[model samples]
Structure formats: C-alpha cells, structure tokens
Target: MTRAHGEVGDPPVGKYEEPATPEAAADRVEDVLKLLEGRWKLMILFQLFGGRVVRFSEFERAIPGISQKMLAQQLRQLERDGLVHRVVYAEVPPRVEYRLTAWGQSLCPALDGLLRWAATRGAPAEGVSDS
Candidate 1:
C-alpha cells in the first residue's frame, strides 16, 4: 500500500512536477497561491498557526483592517479549499472557532521562512509587519 503523505496526496516521499515552462511554473504556483491568495487568508492562517482556535470576530480583530464581509468570504474560501476547519459549539451563544487543517498547519514552517525572507527584503507583504 502506498502511504499518503498529507493533504496533497503525494506518496510518503516524492517529487512534484508540472509543465516545465516559466508560464506553467507560474501557473502552478498561482494555483497553490489561490489556496492562500485572499487578502485575509494568509493572515487568518497565521493567526491560527499557534494552535489557537479563534472566533470570527477574533479573526477580524487580529487582522486589523479587514472588513467582516471580506473576513467571511476569505474564511469560506479557506474552508472550501480544505485548509481551515470551523468548529461550532452547541451553546446559548452558539460559539464558532476557526483553526488550521493539517495541510494548513504544514505550511507554518514554509510561511515562517517566507516571512523571514520578506522581512530582509525592502517591501514586506501587507498584513505582515516589519516589527
């Protein structure tokens, strides 16, 4: 039996390939980027990376300037993409919290490296702070 590595469904250890052209490579990166492309998606994921499950309002607050509508949209997209999980608690207030899925959690190390590199560069991505 072939062992599944993780969400991408690759074997335990394997190489991933796509069409070799620059455009193809770009497209492939864009595809994965789509999984994290929304204005608040990465921020949301980053906020949840510390194993802390947070409510939607908490997510909005953590993101600073993101609107509720955009937050909802981004969360929905992340949920649909299978990178984030929403858990609802049955209670009077009906609490709900968002956390990263296995795939999303796996991105932490890579994201950390990217953040470090971006910090060294002059212009860091929005939502990512120099401080």
Candidate 2:
C-alpha cells in the first residue's frame, strides 16, 4: 500500500520516511537505479508498458539489435524482480506474453518526469553546489 513515488509536492505519506538522512536517501535512490542497470532492461520494460502485452517474438521485432538470447535473459530478470509478469499458454505452438506488474506500471509517472527533466538538457546554474 506504499507508493513507489508520491505525487509532486505531496508530503511523505504511508510508509515513506520523512527527511531521510542524505546518506539513507542516496542509498535508496541507488537501489532503484540498480533495478534498471542492464542495457536492454529499460527498453524491454517500455515495450511492456501502456498495458501492452507482448509475445516473446514480438519483443524481437520491437527492439532492434537485441538477440533472442539477450531478450529472454532480460525478460527473465525482470520477471524475477517482480516487475514483469509472464504468461504462458499451451497450444499447437507454445505461446508466451509479457506485461508489467502494477509495481512496474507505477514507475510511469516518475520516469515520465525524469524524461521531461532530461529533455531540458541544461547546465546547473552558476554557484550551485554539487552537494
């Protein structure tokens, strides 16, 4: 019942810690960044977002320059991390599909904000401390 990231300007609510020590805050952010460490993981997740359920082969077509082996590996890792849900169906030819779990979908707003911030692409103002 805790949120991945709260609404902008909203005070820390639910299980969120308030004014965490800088060290603890950095550590927590680092943990989230680690979840997206792999090269194709983000791309794969993006494909599964938007309520789109993608078949195994469809991923190959969606993401260029990714090998089938690499695609499977990334999907498996995402699934293990509880971010991607995989469904398999028995049929004439076995079928598999991938979609983001609610936890994964919750990342949309945060990532959308990050994307918009990145689009700004400007240097920090003069005299701003790195800290």
Candidate 3:
C-alpha cells in the first residue's frame, strides 16, 4: 500500500532515525515542517494538543476564518501523518471527533521547545534591523 510521501509499505510510524550529517538532519527537520505547511494546520494542531478531543463543529467555532472544507482537509492530512485520531459515533446525526494519537502527543515538548526558541530571539542580530 502507498503511504504518505509516496513510500510503499514504510511502516515505521513515529520512529526517529537519526540523520547521518548535520545537513541531513536539517533536511529531515524541514521535511517535517513541510507536513505542517498550511495556515490552519498549526492552529488545528495546537487545539489537538493537551489531550483535547474536539468535534468538527467545535473546530469550526474555535478556529475562526477557516472554512469547513479546509478544516476537513487539514484533519485528514494530520490523520494520514499519524498525528490525529478520528472517531465516529453512530448517533442520530453521526458524531465525529478528533484527538491526538500517542505519537502526536509526543510533539508537545518539541513544539514547546520551538516556542521557547522563538521567544528567546530577544532582538535582531548585530547587522539586522527590525525596520
């Protein structure tokens, strides 16, 4: 079966394989960034963090400016990436919910580290100007 990124039968989900060189490491990190390269993806991920099980309509309400189609697309991508778990209930109207998988939950600290790193950029470098 074909998987995300078009690799066939690559079954190591959430397993980290250390890159051989620093440049390779950089490339690997950038690849992960590519999976998250959308306006609403990060917002959706932030909502899924902290073990929250959010419904489709709730996501619509929480993330302003995102259309229904965009939300569904983003969620599907996350699910395909093994990040989000989707659950559907057989109720009157058919309830669907989304939450983070264990591997997805592991991203909390990495994202938190990113947040800290961004926060630590006190000012521009010596020659850089904010203007």
| Residue lDDT tens for model 2, 21-59 | 988888889987887889999899888779998998899
The global Cα lDDT (0 to 1) of model 1 is 0.76
- Candidate 3, TM-score vs. the true structure? 0.80
Count of clashing residue pairs in every prediction: 0, 0, 0
Give lDDT tens digits, candidate 3, residues 23-94. Answer: 999998898888788899889989989999999999999999999999998888888877788777767787
Return the top candidate by TM-score.
Answer: 3
Q: Which stretches of candidate 2 lie over 4 Å from their true place?
A: 1-14, 123-131
Clashing pairs in 3: none
| Ten contiguous residues with the weakest lDDT in model 2 | 2-11
| Candidate number of the best lDDT | 3
Model 1 Cα lDDT, one tens digit per residue, 1-131: 12211332321235776678999988977988777776778888889897778898888767899998889888877777777777767676777777777877888998999888978877767798868
lDDT at 16, model 2:
68
Instruction: Give the higher-lDDT candidate: 1 or 2.
Output: 2
